[model samples]
Structure formats: C-alpha cells, structure tokens
Target: MFNFGIFLLLLGAVLVYATVPIIKIFNITTTKGILVVKLSGLALAVIGAIIMFFAQFPQRLEFLRLI
Candidate 1:
C-alpha cells in the first residue's frame, strides 16, 4: 500500500509536470479540459500523500476511524 502510494504520487507529479505536453498531445484547449487534468493530478497527489500519511501513522488512522 505504501509503495502504491509512492507510485501514485510520482505519477501525479509527472502528470502535473507534463501538463502542457499532455495538453498538446491530446489537443485539449478548453479551459475546463485543462482544469480537469490539473485537478486530477492534484487529487492523485493528495490521495497518495494521505495514504502515505496513514501508513506511517496507523494510530492516527485508528484515531480518526477512517479505515
């Protein structure tokens, strides 16, 4: 799970870093389309971070009863 999270984080970073090229590759021009890609990357990074955080602190997960 932890490793998966790291992978997701890296993937998200790549998506974000290559947004422009991605846009060009997909020919995305609309503002909404651009925003969706950006937000998707951000969401992945956040979810990955949250996973890593919980993995590192199991007690916190239990405390929050999130799992």
Candidate 2:
C-alpha cells in the first residue's frame, strides 16, 4: 500500500512536471488555457500528496532504515 502510494505521488509529480511544457507545446493562445493547465497540475499534486501523507512510507521501506 505504501509503495502504491509512492507510485501515485510520483505519477502525479510526472503529470505536474509535464503540464507547463506540454501546454506550451500546443501553442495555447489564451491565458485561460494556461491557467487551466496549471490548475489541473496543482490538483494532481494535491491528490498525490494526500495519498502519500496517509501512506506511512517510512514504516515500509527497509532500505530507508539501512540508510
């Protein structure tokens, strides 16, 4: 479950990480389009963070314990 949560967070980050350049790629002519893209990315990140925070990743990663 923890790993799944982390994966989701990373997935969200990837979505957020892609939003700007991808929007720019399509040559959106309006400010509204840009705003919408940014907002969607923000929503994805928030959802990811919610999952990550509730995941308790620290309790599951043995490798982290070694470090």
Candidate 3:
C-alpha cells in the first residue's frame, strides 16, 4: 500500500509537470481537457496522501490520541 501510494504521488507530480506533452500525446487541445488532466493529477495526489496517512495510522494513533 505504501509503495502504491508513493507511486501514485510520483505519477501525479509527473502529470502536473509534464502536462503539455500529455496533452499533445492525447490530442487534448481544449482548455477543459487541460483542466481535466490537472484536476485528475491533483486528485491522485490527494488520494495518495490519504492512503499513506491510513497506512501509517496505527503507528501514529497513540501519539494522535495524546493530542
């Protein structure tokens, strides 16, 4: 799960950084298409963070409870 989360985070970063090439490859010319791709990337990054958070939740639970 951790590895998958890391992979997703990297994938999202790449998508955001390489948006132009992705748009060219996919023939996505519209502004909406670009927006969609960027939004999906953001969503993937958020999901990856959530996954990582849960993956390590048990180890951090005690500390969290103290707060």
Candidate 4:
C-alpha cells in the first residue's frame, strides 16, 4: 500500500511535469487544452496525496496488509 501510494505520487508528479513541457512546446495558449491538462494533473495529484495520506494511517496500513 505504501509503495503504491508513493508510486502514485511520483506518477502524478511526472505527469504534471511532462504535460507542462508539451503544452509549452506546442504553444498551447488556448484555454481548452490547458484547462483540461491542469484539471487532470490536479485530479491525479489529489488522488496521489489521498492515497499517501491513508497509507500512513495505522488502521489503513493494517487493512492493506490484510489484502
């Protein structure tokens, strides 16, 4: 669980970092694509943070261990 959480966080960070360069390279000044990318990145980061946070809790850790 902890490992998964860390993986998710890293993946999210990578996605955000990667997408930024592409957007910049293409000169994506339009609101649509930029908004979509931003929203997706935000969602991914939030999900990753939530997973990491729950993984740190003792009860959640125990529950995860059971799985």
Candidate 5:
C-alpha cells in the first residue's frame, strides 16, 4: 500500500509537472484549454493524496499482515 501510494504520488506529481510545458507548447491560453489542464492536474493531485492517505490507515496494515 505504501509503495502504491508512493508510486501514485510520484505519478501525479510528474503529470502535473509535465502538463505545464504541454499547455505552454500548445499555447493553451483559451479559457477552455486552461480549465481543462487545471482540472486534470487537480484531479491527479487529489487521487495521489487519497492514495497516500489510505496507505497510512491501520486497516491497510491489517490487510497487509493477512497477506
């Protein structure tokens, strides 16, 4: 779980980091394009945070122990 969380966090961070240049490259100055990029980035970040949070729960420890 911890590993998964770390992976997700890193993936999300990378997605957000990479998106900046992509938006710039496409000249995404329009309101719609800007909104799309921002929303996607925000969604990724949220998913990453959720993964990390779940990884820290006691229930996850018990599940791991069962394995």
Candidate 6:
C-alpha cells in the first residue's frame, strides 16, 4: 500500500507536469484533451494522498491518543 501510494503520487506528478505529451502518447489527439488528462492527474494525486494518509493513520492515531 505504501509503495503503491508513493508510486501513484509520482505518476500523478508526472502526468500533471507533462499533461499534453502524455495525452498524445496515449493517442488522445485533441488540443482540448489536455484539460481532461490534467483533471485526471489531479484526481490521481488526491487519491494517492488519501492512500498515503490512510497508510499512516494508525501511527498518527496512536500518537494523537498519547495526548
């Protein structure tokens, strides 16, 4: 889970950084296609962040409970 979350975060970052190029590689040939791909990248990044949050939730809860 940890590794996958990290990988997703990186993938999202790359996708966002190279939105148009990646879209072209996928053979989505439209000038406005970048908008959808960029949105998907943002969604992936948010999902990855959620995964990472859950992955560390136990430890965080433990620490919080210590208070």
TM-score of each model, in listed order: 0.78, 0.59, 0.78, 0.56, 0.53, 0.67
**lDDT tens string, model 5, 1-67?**
6567667677666666787687888888787886777677777777777776766545545665432
Residue ranges of candidate 2 with Cα displaced over 4 Å: 1-20, 56-67
lDDT of 2 by residue, 1-67 (tens): 5666667667667656786677768987688887776677677667777776665666446556432
> Which 10-residue span in candidate 3 carries the lowest summed lDDT?
58-67
Cα-based lDDT at residue 55, candidate 1 = 66
Q: How do the residues 1-67 of candidate 6 rate in per-residue lDDT, one tens digit apiece? A: 7557777888888889997678767988776787788877888888888786667545444665333
For all the candidates, what are their Cα RMSDs to the real structure?
Answer: 5.9, 3.9, 4.2, 6.0, 6.0, 4.4
Question: Each candidate's lDDT (Cα)?
Answer: 0.82, 0.68, 0.81, 0.73, 0.70, 0.75
Candidate 3, lDDT over the whole model: 0.81
Error of 3 at 10 (Å): 0.8
**Ranking by lDDT, best first?**
1, 3, 6, 4, 5, 2
Window of ten residues with lowest summed lDDT in model 1? 57-66
lDDT (0-100) at residue 63 of candidate 1? Answer: 67
Q: Model 1: per-residue lDDT, tens digit, 31-55?
A: 9998888889999999998887666
Estimate, for each residue in 1-67, the C-alpha lDDT of model 4 and write its tens digit.
Answer: 5567677777777667788786988888888988777677777777878887767556545665534
lDDT of 1: 0.82
The local distance difference test score of model 5 is 0.70
Task: Report how far residue 40 has shifted in candidate 2, in Å.
Answer: 0.5
> Which candidate's lDDT is highest?
1
Model 3 residue 20 lDDT? 96
Candidate 4 whole-model C-alpha lDDT, 0 to 1? 0.73
